[model samples]
Target chain A: MTDLLRVVDPGLYTTVQDLGRPHAISSGVPPGGAMDRFAHSAANLLVGNDIGAATLECTLIGPRLVAEAPCLVAVTGADCELLINARPAPMWSGIFLSTGDELHFGARRSGARMHIAVSGGVAADRWLGSLSTNVIAGRGGMHGRPLMSGDVIAAVAERSGPGVSGRELDPHLRPDYSNHTLGVIAGPHMKRLDADGRAALLGSTFHVSRDADRMGYRLDGATLRAAGDELLSFGLVAGALQVPGGGQPILLMADHQTAGGYPVVAVVVSASMAIAAQLVPGDEVRFEETTIEAALRVRRERRAALDSLRS
Target chain B: MPPPRSTTRVRIHPLGDTALLAELGTRLDTALNTRAIALAAALKKRRDVRQAVAGYATVTVHFDPDQTTHEALGSAIKRLATKRPPMEEPGRLHRIPVVYDGPDLESVAGALGLQPQAVAEIHTRPIYRVFLVGFVPGWAYLGPLPEELAMPRRDVPRTLVPAGSVAIAGRQTGIYPLATPGGWHLIGRTSVKLFLPDSDPPSLFRAGDRVKFFGVRP
Candidate 1:
């Protein structure tokens, strides 16, 4: 082990996440990567780390860690209070930590998940080429489980370039959970729904149910009756809005099952998936339909925006 | 080589900006699944493609939007699907030892009007093909359970089925590697660990692997 950070309070739910092992879906593995890739990338960029660097995805509440070595750290996504040694520390910015420094997070003011990117990233156990923790499968990340108090996480601190600190991302690039609308691609199985049923899917608003998690988000409103008997289990991508027999919609998230049998009404475009991920329970969400062409364009623009921040 | 085209063309659809779903066919045919797996294998080699998910009749490809466009990925998949796929390589055979004592064994025996030992004999004989693993990791969906052993999923699903519990549903048989809620009828138990997330290949079975169970003294 290069170095290890002792967990003081793992908080609500903290796990290691990188870009995720997308190809492992063939082996029935869910793509259990960072739910909010936008924030995750931003946090990594703040620390001068690349997109592939493993960052800790703090769910709702964040973890308290004691630094065992000198390194750079940055927190992004949910606008949470960051404190070091009982003093206020900046968020969405890189901060250099000395040995024995204690970092604490408090009160999520925005978004549901936060990303804490450390210099050189977490070298936690990698499974199928990803450091993301898949709790359902009990594999990957730190010991294949949620970070518990007293658990030690390994971080590889060697870097190619000199570590930079005291830098912040432009405010415009920071994620704001205020935008409740998610863009979606029409459907792979939208024909499963009748006209009014499709209308209910896009027309009605959905309140995030408590059932929402990395697997999927269960929405509280809008019923879209699916036509026909049960479908054969088919491949599902992240961001699919599947409406089961109950008529209520369940939006698949990052850690969604590789396959599902439900009828899909629409797919949330990748450009807006991070926006969808940041939604907390009880939050209202609306869907805006976009063409695949437009969705691709939006994604390119977003990626370009993130790339520009690194320069 | 002639342009890739099949009598039944595969439909390429969008999952989003980052992924594309290739619908090989509408029905549940083994040939369709083979094509999906082949297409996935071809797609996975592309630098622009991130991941390819093989389902019963569909292959969902998660790509890097930054490196590739939706149109570009769709075209690549179309080209790949149009070509004749190479024959599938034979899968490795796995022997799983099982204890036939189960809560539903007697009920299943009664339902089939057969002895519990006969049921175990049938369950233990066949070399089941590993269909695409899903529902949970390392939980292989073994198929076509001899028709005689096949039964519909329970009307009421159990809230928590224990790990390594062997089970069956209509036209399918499997073992739960990890405890979770399930609707399949449990018939036995296995001692093998099917998944280790920390390992290089986390899952023990892939799509086409062969599996056979043997009765073990309990």
Candidate 2:
């Protein structure tokens, strides 16, 4: 038995996400995992938990969790107003909570999603080798769906233990979702675009369209269509910048389909996936082309930076 | 003599630090799928490579960058392509009892110049091989749809396709395990639970499985 965190209000939309079902995608299962892997890992690392530990992936607004057992908790990603018992609490660091403490998440001050990592990670059922919630399929996570009001999420078997507290991370490493400049590596199908088509994609700024979900970020910007090329449905990677028939581009995200027919112009670099995930509808985004080598180096640096944070 | 017919070659690309894609062929081919399965089998042996997601003509290998680098993973993929794995024995035949009374039964029969019974007979004749399982869970993309019964996807997809709805589109046929918006023509339904989330194996059919759909009145 463990402390049960009863959900008082399951905010705008919340789901449990981790590294996700990477293996399951081949089986036609969408890689339904955390939209922003970097932040998800960081939150767990902050509280001395495994990086892939299942955490509450709070989208926009967050849930009101009433802790039934004393434990340590940390919140990262989109900067939301986090409070414990109506009093403001610090995010990005573990906050020690007593049994029966109510954790309130207010309006989002920054970013579009937030991750709440409880100490020892949350106890959940794993489906097809992952604990990540696939809401579309209604499998995995706590009871295979989003947290509902009065739902009690099981904490680890041993909830009351030595806890890490008040340890904040470096501010420089934290991303500001306000300025969205995503780095990309030009194409699996870059040459398919004509000169103007290329310019339209690279030159103009695109706003994150409302037709956005975990599947992809549909961008509204300069019409960047294919140059009379018939596209065959093939394997797609996360962050693929695809130009569908509509002329507008869609950036495939963490939960993208296994394959698509649209021609890919570019893909957001691995280092900028966190930035891509933070974009809310109406957020302006400028796409910057970078070499694959440079993208790899950036990711290496990001990992090293994160490594230094480990005690 | 003209150059001997060329065999399709596999191409590898770095998707990210954590993954790489091995594009086996430009077009969709069963050979590509075979190669993907072989690559997946080979990569599974590698401690560094975590998973291999085989798609149309490509298999994306997700790896732990900390354990392996892009260059090393690429080399492994290249090495596997040089020496491919032989295809496993064809999957066992599965009898799927389906009711041949779908909303589109008449329309599909009219389009194919066949009676509704003939359509059902054709659908159940050959043991359809499972090319892949995607779009939704428990939804196996079983096909070659027998040339005669094949038709393009409906222009206007239904808003809600009920679970167990057996549908066909293009050259593929599958059952919708859950209610979802789809463009595939619904011909009938089945009673067997194709997907049970809480059970082990979760998915009833794996890639390469063979299925035989039979008409069941009731």
Candidate 3:
């Protein structure tokens, strides 16, 4: 292991993440990981690392760091301006950093989160077989919390030889963050919602409220009236759209609780989860009903696209 | 009298493209919870399943869409749901002590039209079963709360509830494993820690476990 970067300014809620602890969900642990999986994998591939390798998930603003040693790095997602020693650098491409070179992020042009991957992957404390951080439980990653100033992030391995840089992802393959419509499949409890509530769910536009984070995004839209009967708490997954007593729907995200009692009206499909992950507060979003067959087909297409990038 | 055999038919529904929920039943009966636990255990053994989580009356099976389709897994679940595995032994039982001096204790007693001591006595009467372990890390949902003590959750939830707080809501009671926001009615506090992050399982209780609480001097 080698020390790679020392954080100078820990931007808004940065944490180390990989694919996350999917197996630990049965124990009430949320599958905490990079919100935007596509960007995370793209960043890792750009740096010639495994797609599941740990990367820094920067929220909103990006961190300022100084290189501790020579390393290859890449940044993807959230159109943030990458800077190397005050000089603007291109994103979605691998860049070689020399020892003591300062790396900074300027204004974000779009999206909400960015993934930065080093060639050897970020080294972090693992919990339940994952390097991803679960901030709520305070387990895994760097002390199981957000990155702080002065924290030295290390790489799992050093580059064996002179590393290649200028590896760029095709712009056409990138996800479009500007798209507001997310495809969703009917949830198990769709019948719980009244007829009007069901209509409003698919027809109306909702705005992402300020209460948005990795846990979930609360959407403000038409009041959805459902049968008043209380629901038995059941296992929940990221992308489940739950409607509570207040009528506003909440879209569960990467760090959502494992189980909940609120009735889920619909679940955002796997293909559109990346789109939901990039949404910021005040972003207008609408849901389009889709079939499970279509959802699976889209997911397969996405996997194929990522696989092509791998070769 | 021996308990009547459970005849609950399993209903499977797609949670999304990647997972399916097998609803054994809607009510919080012990039989339904036990069946849910059994179904989850069976699903966990399958190669296609990534994780099988048992809830109050449901088992959510997550799988890779590329490896298996929802229909394929759903039929397998249905087949497995019908075959009752040899009845397993009951889960381990834990006896916990609680100090009945919570701030909401008197209010809860008043709402139930009973003295606070009676409320404590009733709370300690039954050996509750853990129907699920969720909502937060190491938090267990133990239920079948005596109908007399059944109360709705607080209108205004506490911003921060302390760990080891023994609380009740609806027909269930649970101990807060970590300090978090809660809506349950706090009736007592326990000294035992429910969450052990460093441990292998990290939780003191799991689905199908039994818990019995007794009052202790403050």
lDDT of 2 by residue, A168-243 (tens): 7777776556668888877767788888878877888999999888889889989886875454355577888888
Q: Candidate 3 on A1-311: residue-level lDDT in tens?
A: 99999999999989999999888777788888889998898888877788999999999999999999989998988887899999999998889999999988988887899899998899999898899998877889998999999999999877532367987887777766788899988898899887888889999999999999999999988988667679899999899999888888999999999999998889999888999988999999999999999988888776776766565
DockQ (model 2, Cα): 0.44
Give the chain B TM-score achieved by candidate 3: 0.95
Q: Which stretches of candidate 1 lie over 4 Å from their true place?
A: A1-6, A68-70, A98-101, A151-154, B1-6, B66-68, B112-115, B124-126, B196-199
- lDDT values, one for every candidate: 0.82, 0.79, 0.89
A109 in model 1: Cα distance from truth in Å? 1.7
Better of 1 and 3 by TM-score: 3
For model 2, the stretches where C-alpha displacement exceeds 4 angstroms are A157-162, A227-233, B1-8, B67-71
* lDDT value, candidate 2, whole model: 0.79
Docking class of 2: acceptable
Q: Which lDDT value does model 3 have at A124?
A: 97
Ranking of all candidate structures by their TM-score, best first = 3, 2, 1
- For candidate 2, the per-residue lDDT at A230 reads 58
Q: Model 3 chain B, poorest ten-residue lDDT window?
A: B3-12
**Per-residue lDDT of candidate 2, residues B86-161 (tens digit):** 8567777789999999999999999999999998898888888776665566667777678898898898889999
